[model samples]
Target: MEIQEKKNIYVGVQTTQTRDIRDFFMEIDSYKNILVFAEVGEDKVCDNSLELLGEANRLKNIRNNDSFVIAALVGHNVKKYAPTLFGYGADKVVAFDSPMLEVYRSDLYGEALAGIVRTYHPEIVLVGATALGSELAPTVAAKLRTGLAAHCTALKILDNGQFTQVVPAFGGKVLGDIYIPNHRPQIASIKAGITKKLDYAPKDGVVEDFSCELNGFERMKVTKVEKETETCKSLNEADCIVVGGFGIGSKEEWSKLEELASLLGGANGCTRPVLDAGWVSNEKAMIGTSGVAVRPKAYLGIGVSGAAHHTCGIKDSGLIISINKDENAPIFACSDYKVVADYKKIVPALIEELKARKG
Candidate 1:
């Protein structure tokens, strides 16, 4: 926190950006409403999609032309989720349901989302930065010829109606605030867990069906889909996470991290190298841009060198405690607490203390 304060003092947080209405293209004035891509799974709107709606509702400006929170649902039998959208804060829902969208093809989903944006002319477009959304958001933005801010941690609208997008840059060293001052639709893909879902209410909202022909493709075929079975709670759901890195040295060492997590009633995760080393068989346990981004209440790192790729994901953790032998490891800069010691010493002591307390 002191390092961040120093940075804030030396280098101002570049948060303000503005543009005159005259600077905007003539058609830019046509944009209205905050359109959120409502990603549906298992016949229900995904929580990340609901998170986007709640955030959009919170950021919507009525004075700036009554920016309604409009959710664009595109999937097979997605109309069933219209009420769920309304309950979550959507003022209106536009549904595009078809067999083509049943299976997520980037082209198909992108077309559906792009078509919705073109037709709606939304002032802002929000997408959850999931595996699917990371691909779909860029594809739609390209099709619409608009600027998109990907993997944003924060978003806000200035009094001048400029949309601000905040993302971590330089490998979580500093936060970069981006703005789309002239675009008709300011598009952004929000990283999951940055915000929570709104409370459900029996609010009435309008649902509209949008019909369009999608170009067919046989470039790829999915014969069968299988879901990955996770042995531990998802990183997003766990309040605490015990993460191991390649520095763990051996498969046996990695087991200690898992043991710690299990005892704490939390989840276990690893950096990419730990998985590559064959210490972790569950690929879903990797945390980074290549994996899940977690914001747990407490995150304990064992032998983590804190590469930017890994730190970017853990930077938001509430209480980051890194245990490493290297005094100069990069993670110490960002962690709330640091223990310059070997995991072999810290792990056993921690486990013993917990067991003693239990007894």
Candidate 2:
């Protein structure tokens, strides 16, 4: 951390065409700095950016030298977030602020991000695998003629300085580790909430302005954008989660999961199958390798068959209670408390027990 502080002192001295940029590229095949794509929405920085910043901070500490964690922030009025990014361990923030960037247009954001990459030439670039990032990362990568690993579940800087990208393969049956040895800036769009956010620490970091014009990119203009407001508690933040799977016989049974969750002072979650079956009304409720990964204090799996993808999401739960009719359900192998019974019978009993205790 002290090393990064010293490096940030002179970061503002790099002119747009200074020999530093050219010299760094000419002398070193790969720069040591890590870059994170900080996406903004509703004039606020998204949590995914902070997650990546946190991971980048850890990676920087592990590298433990002059390595810096820089953030590429693009949006209107997002310069106010520079201090927050610095608190999250960003050594410097390259902000591209324009009225044209108020809303997310893939082409505009991509072009701006690509320009940053061409100028700074970081060793690794991390982006969130959200809707915007899924589209934005590839576009920037294509423009820069680089490869990107999408939906990465894990990232590690190997002993040989190669960035190892880990993602689910063959429909979550196995995990594949990917590395881009030839690319200058190894890019990866990772899933959100996989890593914990770092504690805030004030730092002396510079927020440099990057200019972009949309004169020729008029075709990529965003006419209108409607934002969705969320009222439900986020599954990732829930301390306790009650999840149902395809074994949840019907929609009515799925509703019982909500009631059970309320009784437990928690929230309801579901596997991908349950979401696909229309049992869960919201996709945010789904927990799997493809969806949100949760590590709650206590997780109750009702009628869950425990697919590999689903179990992988909850593997970090403090206490996993799997209640499935099948005694040999795979979830039982990883569960701390296993009950061999139908959820239809167990759900009511749990609610009643909790009610009696309250009485």
- At residue 145, what lDDT does model 1 achieve? 62
lDDT of each: 0.80, 0.79
**Model 1 worst lDDT run, 10 consecutive residues:** 5-14
- In lDDT terms, how accurate is model 1? 0.80
Each model's Cα RMSD: 5.3, 8.4
**Candidate 2 ranges with C-alpha deviation above 4 Å:** 1-28
lDDT string for model 2 (131-201, tens) is 78989998987776566888777777788866677766665656667766555577888767776689988
How many pairs of residues in model 2 come into backbone collision? 0
Candidate 1's displacement at residue 69, Å, is 0.7
Q: Residue 185 deviation, candidate 2, in Å?
A: 1.7
Q: What is the lDDT, from 0 to 100, of the residue 356 in candidate 2?
A: 93
